[model samples]
Each structure stands twice: as structure tokens, then as C-alpha cells.
Target: MNTKKHWAVVVGLGLLTLSACGSSGGASATGSKTVTLVSHDSWAVSKNVLADFEKQSGYKVHVLKDGDAGQAVNKAILTKDNPQGDVFFGVDNTLLSRALDNGLFQSYEAKGSDLVKPEFRVDQTKHRVTPIDSGDICVNYDKAYFSKHGLTPPQSFDDLVKPEYKNLLVTENAATSSPGLGFLLATAAQYGDGGTSRSSEAESGGGWQAYWTKLKANGVKVVDGWEQAYNQEFSGSAGGKKAKADRPLVVSYASSPPAEVIYADPKPTTAPTGTSYGTCFRQIEYAGLLSNARNTKGGKAFIDFLLTKEFQEDMPLNMYVYPVREGARVPAEFEKYGKQAPHPETMAPTKIAANRDQWVKSWTSLVLK
Candidate 1:
């Protein structure tokens, strides 16, 4: 939430809007070949990276910024029969099943798909989507606030519900936010939810759902989305510079600290915040060709470009995500201040796909009721 001025400048690129309705079946508005990428609003890359793609592929790239991850996916599904963009980017593993179930994407394995780490790969056999970059959702605490109050920062998910920590934590609602859903899955992984055999009934009074009940009782605050939870509620976020939030801890990314240092007004000598990785959730974002794309050849080329060293390396400072390509170099800021959770919690895409809706429903009933 406490984004640097430069980061604000990065997102200042106005959202691109296209008149065409389907992925590639018709000629472009200008009657030229083009690859239109429909992605969440958080997407950013230097102009040069895009220019390079255009130079090599000879197809103009048009990026249409939908809202958040959920909003983007919903739009894609709504436009499925006709299609709105050539490729869909930003569907993380948590929402991968939703896209797959709707038949929104066609398989196109990138040449570089094999370069990705095994853990980051979600759709292996089908190759419906290619892994691009990853981000982790974890609890971030205000160093100044914790130090001022002489309270030790929370180290684990279990620590957040302690009496001393009550009312000090804030997070987005799982039903409404990507980070929220990842956190929900993290809890499920940590506490166990009967491991695929047990039905939703087994989850109600035990495992992750039971943990949510405890968190609700402990006075944890929930917001509608990440911007509200991080910027308006978390004491350590950029909004705190002008108007501080009441809560000192918030659900945010491990890369947030590096972002803070990189974007600081006076350039902080050290990071002003720290992350709690005890139960962090790893979220791998992906790119895929739309099933109805008119330019299937162009879509394949664009998806392949996404997994290349050039595109993957541009991600760190520009978008603040780890490159799925193993040897890609990260910015010095990330090397110094970023926290890569050594043992982040993860679940299989199949299992997550099967249980996601039910898990979200049960979570809502327990925590938001």
C-alpha cells in the first residue's frame, strides 16, 4: 500500500482499451495483425521490453487492463463465446481451475516452459497456461509501531490469534481478494483439511475453518480488498505517511519491503517493515492463449515471449514478482530487502480446484458471519 512515487509513475500508464470483442478472429481496428493481451490492472513493463517483442514477432501488442484478478477472469468468461483478447494473463494458481473449468483457454506450451521450476508449474500435462512469475502473500508488520509498543512481531499464523495480538491484525476478505484467497489456502495447508478424502463436513469444526473461527473471535479485521486492507488499514503502508491506520499488521507480499525501500521519499536507510513467512502462500501468475483467439499463431508467440529471460527479468522492479525462470536475475533491491519464504505453503492445482468454492463458502460462513 505504501508504494513509492516511482512505482506510482510506473502504473501511471493509462489502461489500454480495444474496440474488438473477440480474441483474433477478425482483423484489427486498423486492419493489421496484432496480439492483444488482457490482464489485471497491476501489469507493468518497460516500453523497451514490449518494443522488443514487436520488433522480433512483427505483431503489434495491445494490452487491455481489466480490473483485479477476479474481475479480469470474470470478463474473460463473459466474453468467452466471442473473446475480447488474444491471451489472458494474471490468472494465478488459486483461480486457475476456474479458468480451466470454463474452457476459456487453449493449450500452447511455450518453448521455455521447461525452464520453469517444477513447483511453479500448475498446468503441466495440458499446458493450458505457462508459468510467468510468482508472488507470496504474508503478514507484514510496522517495525516502528512494534518497536514503539515494545511488542514482538508475530512470527506465525498461530501467533496472530494470541490475546496480545488481538485487534492488531488486518486482512482482505477471501471471497473478494487474491491475497485473501491465498491466505485462506495457506491456512488450509498449515492446519490440514483432511487431505482430499474428507468432505466439507470434516472441515467445518476442524482444520482451517476452525482456525478461522478462532481468528474471528480474536478480533482480526477484514476488508473488501488488498488496496483497502493495505493502504487504509495497515499502519506501515504508504497511506500511513499522510493518515496512519489503526492496525500495525497487514496481509501483503514478501516483496513489499523492497518496494518500500525502493520507493521511499527520503530513501530509507533500511526497510521500514518486515514480513512474517511462517505461513506464507505462494501465488504463481500465468499466461495462456484464449480458446477463441483469432490469431492462434500470434498468441503462441506472445506466450513464448512471456517465458523468455528478457520478459521474466523485467518483472522484478517493474511488477515486483519472482521470475519463474530459474536463473533470471533479480534487482539489487530485491536481493537486499526482499524475503523469499523458505517453506511457503502450497496445494496441488487439482485439489485446490475441487475444494476452492466450498472452502471459500465455509470461510465466509465462519469468519464473516
Candidate 2:
């Protein structure tokens, strides 16, 4: 991949760490004391966060910005034998299977990982891929649009395709967008008979296909990326013009609501937008130690540190991603600006690992072509 028609930024942010590891390959310490963190561009936080971790632990940190989720894992696998970075962060459920099956991660669960939400915490293969944080990808409608039009947001996948919203909604292509893929998986979960991912063997694949056809028939303006789909396609931009600020409704992570407020210019005391529609798809993200790591002990500590309260709480505000911790408090902007997706879509990593390429290719040929 060229990412052929995908929301490059969403895929970049969502799967950032999964892209590649070993950027500064083999920059490990002589003894078992230092650690190299081959982080993705999406693997970010206040610089102080990393510094605090380093101070607590004597391990010297070597950090590098690799590519996105898939690329990071790809490089990790390629360099498995030589073992470039000690630890990798933010390889989510979508790429989990490939990361694990390729034998890229070493087994080491974090401390107090047992208290994490069961689904988010477990790496069944015993590979111990630690769940760092999780969030939902759902349909977000501008509150202004719904209120102004005297209409309610779509409650289900089918609601989106109804006549009222024929030209109002915008979505990214699946092959190129992580949010689009998340939306697709949600339909599979709803229609695909409760399966999270649509495999060839999955009966839900038909249901997923049916829903997509209906959505297509409803007249969605398909775009290649989330930025175009959200910032430009949806109505309710300050100008509300497609070319000017077209995207109002989009496929995005649940954390976006808070992100909007957090990232807003000059730092607003309150949020500027509202995500009143809770049409979200739950997505769980994980971190794994490259199968061949330069410093195994250091890798384990870094993963554990990611789960700590400081990191978990800092996640929502800094990275605009939710924390995996059971009782994390959301920022004011997140609670007010962000809304939840009640019925999120899901897919097991294994299923996605098997069919992602084929499905993406078919989708490209069928629709994007």
C-alpha cells in the first residue's frame, strides 16, 4: 500500500504506532539498563511524561517517530531478528493479530493490568499484548445541523441512509481510512450476526454488504480521507460550504470531541463543538514488545508505565484517545463536547488479519474505482 483512497490522517493517527518500529535501530544500552522506544508519530504525549518515566526508572529512553500502525509493525517484523527497539506502543486490535502472529512482540503484561477491562486487557495467545487505551469510532453529526433542521441524528446504521440525509453525510473510503473501517466493522457487528470482523466465512459479511449498499444508495459523497469528509463534507462549518468548510459529519474516534476542545486555538475554557450523537464504534488499542527486543526488561517497564494513572489520565487530553484504565476521569471538554457511541462495531484482530487486504481491495474495485 499506497493507502489508495483512505483518510490518511485518521489512519495515521489511529494506526500511527502500528506503522513501523526500529527507526533508530539498535540504539540500545550496553547493559540491560537502557530502553529504546520506537514510537509512532501517533505515539505522543507531553514531553514531561516520558521524562517522568525515565526519572522513575534508570532506563535511558531512546525515542523515535516511526510511521503509522501497520508500518511500525511491518518494520518490527522485518527487524525481528536483529531486534531494533526494545518496546513498541499503540498497535491496536485492527493490527493485533498480524503483530502477534508475525512473532513481533515478546510476552510481558503490565503491572495491575488485571484490573483493566477484561476485553481490553487480554491477549489470548499469551503473547501479553497490553491494552493501553480504548475508544469508539462512530458517526458524529453536528448538533447545530440537527437542531437547525429540526431533525434527530441517525440512531442506527440504516438511519444514516434515510432520505432526509441524502447529501448531508460524508464518509471516508475503507481502504484508506481507519474511521471508515471502524464504521464498516460496526455494521458487520450489527448485521454480520454479532461478529466483530467480517471474514469470508463470516455470515455477517453479507449483512455488512447489505448495509453498505443501502448507504451507497442513499447518496453519500465518498472521499479519500477523514479531514475532507469531516472538516469539508458535513454541513455546519462556520461557512457550511463544501469547498470552504464542508465536512460537519464524519467517521472519527470518540475522543475527537475532547480533542476538538483541547486542540482548539488559544485553548477555550469550554468546547467549541458538540458530538451529541453517540453513534460510536468501540476500538481497543494495545502495545507489544517487539518479538526480538534489544532490552527485554526495559520493554516490560515501559509498557507497564503506559498503564499507570498518570499516563492513562493524560491520554484523553494529550493524545485525544481514551485510557484503558477502569476508572479514569474525563476532562470537562470531553464530557461536554464528546459523546459516546452506544452500539459500537467490533471485529476480532484475527478476522481482520485474514480479510482486511481482500476486503479493502474489493471495496476499492467496487466503489472507489
Candidate 3:
């Protein structure tokens, strides 16, 4: 070969060698597909369930636990061009519109979307993502406090503002926390309506504004996150933690009841904590695939795993969220601590999506009083 041709041949051989080595390296190592699952903190499922997935699929499921759902989504969006995880979960209905708009999911229906709550099928893709579990953020009052103080549990969103309830409530900040936003949305849903068409009306009149003004006068307090509000403020059988000053009422999930019971050493036959009547707020959670995922197969598999009976039954005690499956088992503690509200109000996903950030921003300003 001429000198130029010899040089070209040598370069071609080097390229071929690199390609074969890369392919062989992938094939030889682990004999497994690594699926990265990015989810919010405290979203742990049953260990056996995940183990089963990793076992059956020959895919090692790597869970990348992040902070809040919003933060997780932000990270996913920033990496959308390159992509990181195979699936993303814990984007609730309140945050669904943003995830969808950002094109974070590739759609595929699960094996049993039919098993999901009928109302949850708002968007359908080949099962790109599916509903797993949900929780309600409600005013969790210490039964002991209310009874001892000779006060009644708060009945309406407006009731939190009453004189007797003064300075007892502590809640998450809506701007930073999912549960905080859930509480805010619950108030918006209960008094007015929260959908796309109507502007959220919170004037000095008879509504959320009026409710908040009363709560302010009643000595309502705000916290940076739910952990502070629950683990610190809410008095439960999980009672080793000291209550923060002026924090008798907390905003927490309904599933907290069961968790308090099961996790307590010497597992209480009955829940150690009691709930407020008609004081609960509802917040439905959701799961979705990343807009750009490297392993769509693993993404769908993970979601499918969540909806299974094993995962569903274990959810209440483990994660403190109600499984979307109609007949999932709930822990006794959850039944005790978590309340199925006498009259739970809900905001549609679309309405929540539209007004969420705006509502949070507005509430931060409004509640500064």
C-alpha cells in the first residue's frame, strides 16, 4: 500500500479495535442493565418488591433518592437533553402538568391501568407512567391537646382561625414543600374551586383570604418543611421528639397514623396518636416516566412493580401513602392516625397545575400577616 493508504488502514484498524472493546466490555460486565430511578425523599417501597424487580428483569434497579418532587423534576429537566435515570416517580397530580409539559415522559400503559382509580387516567401513553399511591395533607391536631384544652377539632378550613385554635398550627411552606402546597390547594379546593377556568379568588371577603386572616389571628405558624412540622410539631406515639413552641397542630399525611403504630417498638395494638375530625386535606400523588429515558423498559417495569399487590399493601405503613389500587391493605396504625375525611375536597390536576406556583407565591405574601 502507498504511504497514505497504509496510514488510513492503520487508523481504520484502531477504530475497529476500540469499537469491539467497548461492545465486549458492556457484554462481559455484570450481564445486567442498570436502571436508575430518581425519586423524592421518603419514597421507599418494600425491599422485597424492588429485589424482585431486580431479580426478574436482570436489571439492577438503582434508586437515586433526591430531595422534594419539585427538585427531582428540576434536575430531570436540566438533564433532559442527555438524560440520567431510566424512570422518574413521585410527581403528584399537582406537579403532573409541569412534568408533562416539559416532555419528561414517554408514554406506555401499565399491565393494569384498569386497576388504577378511574379518575387518575387523565393522560394515557403506552404506560409511560402510572398512578402508584396518594396521600392527603390534613390538619393533624393532637387529640390530647384538643380534648385537654376543651376545644373541638377544626371542621372547615375557616375553623383553623378560631380563637381557641390560636397559635397552635404549624405548616410547611408552600413554595418549597409538596405537602405545603397540598395543604394550600386543599384550602383553595374546599372554599372556592381550583381548575383552569376560574381565577383563584382570595379577597378580604368570605374565602381562603378570610380563612387565612383568621388563622393568622389565631396564631398560625409556618415551617420550612414537613419533617419539621410532623416529626417536630405533631405529637404522636413517636413522641420522643419535643414539640416546637406553639405547634400543637401540624400538616401531615393521613398515612401517618399507621406508620406511628407499626414503627413503634412493641408495636401498639392500637395507634398511639389520634386524628382531628373533618380537619384533613386531600392530595393525590402520581408517577410518570422521564421525558427522555435511556431505558423505557425498566421505567415501565418499575411503575408496574409499584402497582402490584405486594407494593400496594406495603405502601401505607412503609411510605404513609394510600395505594391507588382499590383494595390495598392499610396498616392499623394508619387507620388510627390517618383520617379519611368526612368531607375531603379535591382540586383537579389541571387547575392545580395552573395556579400552583402562583398560589404558593400569593399565599406567602398573604400569610405574612
What is the C-alpha lDDT profile of model 3 across 1-369, one tens digit per residue?
A: 121111000000000111111111121132227777776665665678778878887788777755456766666665666555667777777777777777777777777678887865667645545887766666666656667778776755656766767777887777776667777777776565322322233443355645666667678778777666676666642542454334667777555555655566787676554555455555566666676566777777777877888888876655667777877777655555565665666777788778776776678898863
Per residue, candidate 1 scores C-alpha lDDT tens digits across 1-369 of: 112332321111111233334444332442236888888777888789989999998998888776667777777877877777788898888878878998999988898888998878766789888989888888999999999999999988888878889899888888887788888999888777734412242334478867777788889998887777776888887775556688898888898888888877888988988999885988888889998787888889989999889998998877788998979989988888885798888888888988888998888888888
* Colliding pairs, model 1: 2-238, 22-83, 24-294, 25-294
lDDT of each: 0.79, 0.65, 0.63
Ranking the candidates on lDDT from highest down gives 1, 2, 3
Off by over 4 Å in 1: 1-32, 194-205
- TM-score for each candidate, following the candidate numbering: 0.89, 0.84, 0.82
Cα deviation of 230, candidate 1, in Å: 0.8
lDDT: worst 10-residue window of model 3: 7-16
